[model samples]
Target: MVLNDRIGSARFVTKTNATTLDPFKATEQGYLGVIVNGAPQFETLVEKVHNLRSVFDVRNLRKLSEVVIIYGYQDDPEYMYDAAISHHADGIIYAGTGAGSVSVRSEAGIRKAEEAGIIVIRSSRTGNGVVPVDKGLPGLVADSLNPAKARILLMTALTQTKNPELIQHYFRTY
Candidate 1:
């Protein structure tokens, strides 16, 4: 999307579209619902994302799906495992806490997602860097893009392919 405005002789324009799905409608009134594995790690940042003037002009806010954001309790691998196993998602993003790593149970869920033909990738909430593929990790192709941006990327990736290598390349090219 392109938006230009003039503030008393200062002219400005900016663009924010990254993914191709266009899951967001252009409305300038949207909200993002976040799902976390444990506590509210994004308490300060969420406020910033929502308060950004551009967000309101781009799309309206919506409630986040709670099944994914399992906060305020133990981070069970099965909760996500079950969600993917039950076909509740076309793609799943495992936002690891650091360096895009996963729990043992989380690994089990990831394997399940892959076996069941659901697109799966690693993500990190740290928002500092992209998730790199683990060389020895049994099944993961690559870190789920950048953890901050994995969910949207996964949604778009799933729309194209389910093969791990193809999807891994897609992550690199995307």
Candidate 2:
């Protein structure tokens, strides 16, 4: 079975056994489709698809910017966020406790990062649950994305644009 999803301008495909396919759940989760019965030819699938660029297309590839992820803890020091700035990172994903709630000191560091033109993304350290937008926060929210996924998206987004609003839109859309 082939499961497909799009991220930014990239299209990705995942191949799995047909017996493991769950059609309803896959579609509900926004997967493109599933092919059952027998193993499908991989080359035929890619060759027939039009307009979509190959994942290995070097010409269309953009060099990803540096993104750091900091795990927030109770009374944590601001060193992690500060280090990202010192290292000249393009973005920081804060994996905060609970629904992406950062420590006071972490928030202070995030403020400094924002001032230095680095984009900050608030994501939950918890395995699941959405992190909503908090206007009082210094940077953008990562929605339902975990810290790792948020970091990947942020790196790609930063390569395209530095606009906070546009980056936030990418979080919402992708």
Candidate 3:
């Protein structure tokens, strides 16, 4: 079950012409209702709806926060640093390889982001498994969420608070 938390995921509700589905329309006024996955074989759509409602109560929706995701690779960390600094990002998700293990350059960049008061979230690029919490990272682990979902959750969390401790709690709980 690939559960996408992005507001753009409303395409799942449409049986056809998915391109016609508008994310802004779905979330602009408020969550009108659950958009059931049109694929009948995915019978768990109802449960997914219930879970979504329980986890992200749209009634309490607030302003969207700006969270950027940085992809980790053998490349330099300059891009990561730029996202936090130049973009004035409120939060950042580092898509690290395997268990959210950071490369040396990425680590250096992350520290800079932290120093800038941008909440950093460590997410897995490998697409599965929880990022084990590392006290030395000066950031929150993404739990079982991948980079994309981590960005979404971090954006939502930043809306509530900028405290890394409180944001970390959201990472663990949500």
Candidate 4:
């Protein structure tokens, strides 16, 4: 089955086959393409969809905020994190090496970003594997999501709230 989790572009629960698609349902769920299944076998709450859409609408109209993804490397210089802060990014998804571990210098930059009111999410550049919560880490973990997916969720989560706990909950949930 083509589950939403496997379809990189799917925003919500979607199932597809060869024929018969529901464009309306896909649109409602924030998808632009066709779904060959009847209705979505799984559905997200209307309230949730509304909230996500509202945030996207405001962002699209004003361009007041942005979400950035930065890759971590050995002996990292932290320039990308600093740049994100300077650019007024609303959120950052740090794709750290191995299980989302950043170099000392990069961590310092992350701390500065957090101090600047930018929410930082720790994800892995390893492509697959959960970035579990580490007490030593300065930001929320991205769970099993890769950097790109983490960025998408972080962008949506930032719209509803900046509370690290709540955003972390979203990472664990949707």
Note the clash tally of each candidate.
Answer: 15, 0, 0, 0
Regions of model 1 farther than 4 Å from truth: 1-75, 138-145
How many pairs in model 3 have backbone atoms within 3 A of each other, for residues 3 or more apart or on separate chains, i.e. clashes?
A: 0
For each candidate in the order shown, give its overall lDDT on alpha carbons.
0.48, 0.74, 0.68, 0.73
Give the poorly placed runs of model 3, Cα more than 4 Å off: 1-63
Q: What lDDT does model 1 reach?
A: 0.48
The best candidate in terms of TM-score: 2
Residues 1-174, model 1: lDDT tens digits: 211211110011112356754433322322222234532222222222223442123233243321132211136546656765685666666667676666777776677766776666666655445566787443443343443345555554555456678767756654
Error of 1 at 17 (Å): 19
lDDT of 4 by residue, 98-140 (tens): 9999899989999999999999999988765678899987989
Ranking by TM-score: 2, 4, 3, 1
lDDT of 3 by residue, 1-174 (tens): 222332323322222234654323322222323335643233223323425544455566656788888888776566657657778888889898888888888888888888888888888887546789977765789887778878888887766678878777777666
Q: What is the lDDT of residue 160 in candidate 2?
A: 72
- Stretches of candidate 4 off by over 4 Å are 1-64
For every candidate in turn, the CA RMSD to the true structure comes to: 14.4, 7.2, 8.3, 7.5
| Per-model TM-score on C-alpha atoms | 0.52, 0.70, 0.65, 0.67
Model 4: how far residue 126 lies from native, Å: 1.1
Which is the winner by lDDT between candidate 2 and candidate 4? 2
**Candidate 3 to native Cα RMSD, angstroms:** 8.3
